[model samples]
Target: MSHSTLKASVIISIYQDVEALHAILYALSRQIEQRFEVIIAEDCECKAVREYLAQHTFPFAINHLTQEDKGFRKTKAVNRAVAAAKTEYLMFLDGDCLPHSQYVAEHLNQRENNRVCTGRRVHLGPTMSRWFRKKPSLIKLIENRLVYTLLGLPLVFDHTKNYEIGFRSTTLHKRQAKKYLTIVGCNWSVSRADMLKINGYNEDLPGVGGEDDDLGWRFNGKGIHEKSVKFVIPVYHLHHVERRADVSTNLQIIKQNTAQKRYYCKNGVDKYLSETHEKLKSNA
Candidate 1:
């Protein structure tokens, strides 16, 4: 990679999880020799998260922003954040996620033409065994669905092991790219150009559930394959409070898009970004 390519940016979508945001920021600060800008898009209606990020000194300069008063869906906040990114490469990490030290370097190394790279997610809270012993209600499921149109899986009966089934590693390597059925927006990296092509994520996604799946569908349709980085770079998912369902219809949208390959094609996000340079200027 050239010096130009080394210029990358990290984009994170945040709502009200101050604790998770702090953890993510600390993990990112440990990277000793890299230079990249981190943009945090606070989608929540509150100012607490913004205040916290402002008070801290991160390893890299941090750009913090907020959207107009809107509900807590992640898509709007993230899009606003990406529009402000100042790098050739864009890495999306969830506020609740703890990336390994080599996370950014690993993704930068794996980047290739028309490709989106995603890594594995490991649960970081009490063992699955413990979860079953203290089975919590599906409060999270309901909140996620009703509040954000997102979905959370039922607690596994066994907690001794990681929730391996929830997040299986991708097997693809850097050189070869192939279409994928889905890509997790969190812990995934793609050129800012590629993202805008799919309209910077379906703002009309109806909820939080299928935004990633929708992006995967759009990429596959556009011939942009998904590559897994799990065998190499792994992320720890800090256990947190379950979310209430704000909406559940978006999952169905993803299912339909995946089945139909709704946005699969050759020309995609790259073209979109190029055309909308003025609109998404910051990310470029």
Candidate 2:
């Protein structure tokens, strides 16, 4: 797919949540900065999601990619999306999480040549999740963040944690100089040129839980360590059930990788890179 000149790409990893994806897209369209494209990296090719995407349009370009639904292969799914990304700079967001209005702008502002930027999220509980499911007005949530944060503090929304991360301000937007920053896949950004050097996500990872930590580990080995943007960029995570089926395997793989000091894994985005992509890398 040909792309226009874009400042960055927002690659969203999703399953069969077209409704939540709609709200996500709505939030992306209203970002304070508007120079990025979106890529939907779906783990399965569900017909409903395809139909919904075909019917809707956003201000920025949108592309969707899907693989056969075998099981929890988020590594394979997102690696493919990263290989398909048009810009050198990009971010990863879960389908259920909504980015703050200044999310992209702040990320762009703080991007360093050889470092990845990672931040935290505000996890919403059942009550607020139900309210947003009925009417997902992300703008309303941001505008009245104090009211919502107070409600969440009292447990009125069940277990909506991380209220401190919800607030955004230029005063607090400074990146931490920490050398080893643990990551959450839902709110992170890295350069395509740098990520390809360590090979994207380790496709050898079996499940969802520890890929971020694994990636951060490898990034440090490759001299592309992480910088903290904790109190800087905020994302609201809609509630969802926990998925821990094959998470044990991920932890095992991470342990093995760290023990062996494996910076570049045998399986990753390299397998999915096309000839055009190779030339793109070579030219870089």
Instruction: Give TM per candidate.
Output: 0.71, 0.90
Error of 2 at 248 (Å): 2.5
List the lowest-lDDT window of 10 residues for candidate 2.
172-181
Q: Write the per-residue lDDT of candidate 2 for residues 29-90, one digit (tens) a residue.
A: 87989989898999999999999988987889887999999998888888988888888898
Residue 42 miss distance in model 2 (angstroms):
0.2
Which parts of model 1 have CA positions greater than 4 angstroms off? 1-6, 126-181, 244-247, 254-284
Q: Residue 172 lDDT in model 1?
A: 34
- The list of candidate 2 runs beyond 4 A from truth reads 1-4, 145-157, 170-180, 275-284
Clashes of each: 26, 0
For each candidate, what is the lDDT? 0.63, 0.83
Q: How far does residue 279 in candidate 2 sit from its true spot (Å)?
A: 12
Q: Report the C-alpha displacement of residue 23, candidate 2, in angstroms.
A: 1.0
